[model samples]
Target: MADRDTVHYDGPAGGWGSLRGITRIFGKELPAPGVLDTLAHQNKPGGFMCTSCAWTKPAHHNPLEFCENGAKATLWELTTRRCTPDFFAGHTLCELKGWSDHDLEQQGRLTHPLRYDRETDRYLPCSWEEAFAAIGDNLKRLDPQSAVFYTSGRASLETAYLYQLFARLYGTNNLPDSSNMCHETTSISLKKVIGASVGTSVFEDFSACDAIFFFGQNTGSNSPRFLHPLQEAVKRGCRIVAFNPVVEKGLVAMINPQSPTEMLTGHETPISSHYLQVKAGGDIAAIMGLCKHVLDREDEARARGESVLDHDFIARHTHDFEAFTDKIRATSWEEIEDNSGLTRDALREAGEVYVEAERVIGIYGMGLTQQVHGFDNVAMLVNLLLMKGNIGRDGTGISPVRGHSNVQGQRTVGISEKPELVPMDKLARLFGFSPPMEKGLNTVETCEGVLAGTVKAFIGLGGNFLRAIPEQEAVAEAWQRLELTVQIATKLNRSHLVPGRAAYLLPCLGRSEEDRQAGGPQTVTMEDTFSCIHGSVGRRKPASEHLLSEPAIVAGIAKAVLAPNPKLRWDDWVGDYGKVRDLIEATYPQEFRGFNERLFTPGGFYRGNSARERIWKTASGKAEFTVPKELSATGFEDRPGRYRLITLRSNDQFNTTIYGYSDRLRGIEGTRDVLLINPDDMARAGLAEGQVVALASDADDGRERRVGGLKVLPFDLPDGCLGGYYPELNPLIPLSHHDVQSKTPAAKAVPVRILTGAAASG
Candidate 1:
């Protein structure tokens, strides 16, 4: 078959109107009667801001910054499909479960508010007040910890802030958010090395960098808008070094559908100067190899009496480098060479790029963060950057390309389980309520806590929390124990499966839709990947008029649970979101400076963080570094029937939403069950490509998940590791297997084996 690594696409690359033409042809497109004009792209002369990927290329920061995925997000958000109650009345919950993701969303927009009817197995129309009262009653019945306050990346800062506060007022600190699942390890490790979990560089820095190192991130499909800046870097002679098992089109060179120059010439931008296909879960080894190469180059340079690194930056800004150097020197070159899955030649070339270039920026994504040794993998990258004095400088820093618009911003605004002394101490001082000092549950911890029946409720700001987790069956069962589960969502997906004793589906306005309350139309705030927070106002009507804004719902529940809350003013802010903004400004002063007035500005001002630039807010006010003896190698168990399986989202999907029908890069369409495996391993097991296989997870109890009837595509994966799409294969992952420090499911480190068997069901 055509060389296995080759990417093929039959779909027409019809720039902008591809979706519009399809909408006219097909009946299933928008949630309302017609498509709304709600893309985050600022095409209008001076219209509203984009609510898609946080990256803003407005003429101010403009270098033409829309990624492919960002375009898809904009297109999807501004759809014309509607799922009226009449549509649901015509179908059953059972039918909807069997429907494809595109089919479910394509049915139309949710025209009216819907509530799950247990007796009838159908979603019936329910008023916003009725849904709110039902949710309030459920919150009144349980302890706060049982209910998890989950947030999706698809929310505004205003909604996310209000949701987190309401959960705190209800006495629960189980804020298991989207960040806990993807880049918490990046935040954790970056905090130690650079004093911040966020990538230290801004988009403008890419323009000035001489070299860019991409580790484990497939940006083209995952975050397409980044291509413009990357293309510019290439045009200016900045070499791009990409390291990952899969060679993505976006990372390589796919003609930018939006670029007039590339489109006119029908030519693609050359994405990478050197593409290193490292084995899966070999990031630490790869990073350590790069470091060793740099040291070797330094040694050679010392012969000529010239230093290969920035000694002054290291001497003044860092601590314990002598010990770090000792460890680096003692590390065996053999381990680095073998474990990294890259040749010395490749690493040497990478090191040359670092040494030759005066300034370098390392841009990475979740592939670097979701490993068994995720934290250490991140630390190793930090160590590489530190060796060259990359932080706190112009045109050189670590830029972690975050997923979901503003996912990182949500964590900054108090969605984290790891409480800093500043926010925790301030919360007790300002609100006059004793905050829970015990470290609460994270993503996997929340799930395990629920399985043990400690957590009683779950309130999601947005996203498919159930489908997003690993081991779908066990997570689904754990969710069944909750006293109440509420999803404040724009569209429904797999999360509703966790039917609590009382489940409330509150329909809310999306970023593309307008949010109106008693205080007139209100705009919400969101932060981009660069940690820039700004406001978002929907240009279209609500998907359903019966829907309420997330803030109003949060306030409603706060009023219900904190009936006797003396200091907490819930209704006051509900009447006017500006009051909510005022409270946010008063509480977290780092952001929201003159909250309302700032929105009137063009794209809003960047809330500068000194801490983000290596200014540690830790106890000693210096970043701390710790290495888990058992990291990245955590899932490298030599079990007989087990292999490390990393769960990933496909280019066709965003977070847990299946936006498109296929992953064209992987040669699969109309299916998510295809597993990426090494050809040698498949042959060793006597398995052929396109084989239907049964996977029995060795979770002590021998949990057998029959996800059979699947194709086995041989890929450039490490011999002992396999890769698959998440949420669907989540059932194979045990809820107990998680990172000790982060409480995140080792989604990048799950171990499972394949067998020929029957189709698996959830």
Candidate 2:
């Protein structure tokens, strides 16, 4: 193995660095023709949505509206390379299993449907009809409740709607999705506090806000396009405050690639005016500290015959204020300072900035949601927003920067495991079938069921489910117990390598590929993070003639599985995607009126939010003020030689997909095996920089979960906290370690001990 090089990057984000990334991906992946056409059409009006981040686009987009990662995602899908039957014929499943994730995907896109051959220990080409027939037969042999249908955020709105419809009509609601792993905490908490599971503000809100606070989100790398609005906000003298464990380069400064002067001068626009390096999993305490400061200021103002709190708004639009205030008053400042890893003066200063601003917007990411207290963390954010009447108004609200391109849309179009959230009666009236009323399995529940031998069949719409889930070895074992497993994907992933008794790999058309049916070329719709419904039309030809559209593949499976149902018009829906949109409009007329026509409009239409209109549909008929309890650090605090571990994505990766081994932002090159630790922690642990070590989880579950050969490097993180790349460290996170309410894996906060020298070698 080659040793990785570590260097500290001192320049601002974006500018030439981002441009170089775009050029490198295109040069490596698209050596063929149609490169310019593909680049021009990305994120344009009536063009395909970039299958990267869920950031909303402007009303009128430039020809080159995509960011660096967006270009990489597009190139990854439209690469000239192909993984044909001949390639699979030469490589056995056992051989492929040894290949790294980057190598497996570098083999290129899957060109045809494949089935595992047990005798040969390889995957061979198979007809789509034959594969679907066998899968349908297996599914028929098992109970509907025994089969779990999984959906990825990459699935378009139309595809997701049809997927849920099929799963519900099949007599089961066993639907789990990618959202369950990432933003389910935001959804669950927001629904309870604000009567909506989504962000209340639109993209335009960035322009009107006087202050913007970002927690646990790296705006420059994860969602590069968002920097445009943020940079603009900074230019207009807007205050930006960030609370994170690491001082991310993106939060420090950003250079707009679209600005000629910035590119020429190498000048950067400052992002965060204040940066607070809070401890990992200490967001709740930090937020509470800020709230306490605000309350103290309010008391002082009252004594001076002035006002700091929005008493009128709070009295008119919220509830539970007394309990909420009492809890904040009870929280001691010393405890807050210890737990948050920040000084009381710093928290007071942040509160002063927040108070001075007329309007503020709070944005967060997985750092706030992927923990044991994720729900409480999110609720605390809402509490701060509600105290100042930041929600349900222009220029102010809470925003969760979603990672997936259409994750919000997928949930909006009925991808939830909860049947009550989806209108079953309306769906039954439209489809002529009684949908199951009982709640079904989520991602975590599905895994448990599979391990218990209850779930026999699994179908993935679009994701590397096995690699994304926690407890890698155990999840792999549970997958093997399944009678049938099917994956609809654009390329090969680790999930396809781990097979069940009968496994099928079905290749589908990517977001950049044309989907031609009996009704000629069809356009799919997507919902962005801001709840804007827009159309995405791919102009490029399909990578392979054998590859099918997601809708076509889902429709085929539905046709085969629910055979002989006269009322179901799967063939008709497959012929024209408009029929799918028609049914969606019929099902959700209020939210999707004139769905087809509105999709053709410039920038599409907004899915109006009741919360934004100050019309709370919550059970209390008003916005809620939730009282957050005290938060405890991970149990490792008392355990000597143990540290809190946080799993993170490298700059070259999107979720589990690795584009390269290097993370340019953090200055690590040619490898992803380095662990970031605080200098103080390194001294206390008797470890030096660049030392190779082994990391072992302190789960106390009697299983030795460990990862070896990690190079340690001192970082600017808090003492007793360590950081490592995801999927590699996913094994250290137990499947049972998740939020109590959201069931999201606590990948952000894990307890582990580092072993060096002879201990590591053993």
Q: Candidates' lDDT values, in order?
A: 0.68, 0.86
Best of the candidates, lDDT: 2
Which residue pairs show backbone clashes in model 2? Answer: none
Residue 590 shift from truth in candidate 1, angstroms: 3.7
For each candidate, give its TM-score against the true structure: 0.91, 0.98
Per-candidate clash tally:
39, 0
RMSD of each: 3.4, 2.3
* CA error at residue 512 for candidate 1, angstroms: 1.2
lDDT per residue (tens digit) for residues 526-622 in model 1: 6777766666666676655676777777887676667666777766776777887786787778666687777645545577656446676555465
Please give the range of 10 consecutive residues that has the lowest summed lDDT in model 2.
Answer: 1-10
Superposed on all Cα atoms, model 1 deviates from the true structure by an RMSD in Å of 3.4
lDDT of model 1 at residue 207? 81
Tens-digit lDDT track for model 2 on 628-742?
A: 6556534235378777898888778888888887677777788888888877788888888889999988886777788889999877787778999988898888888888788
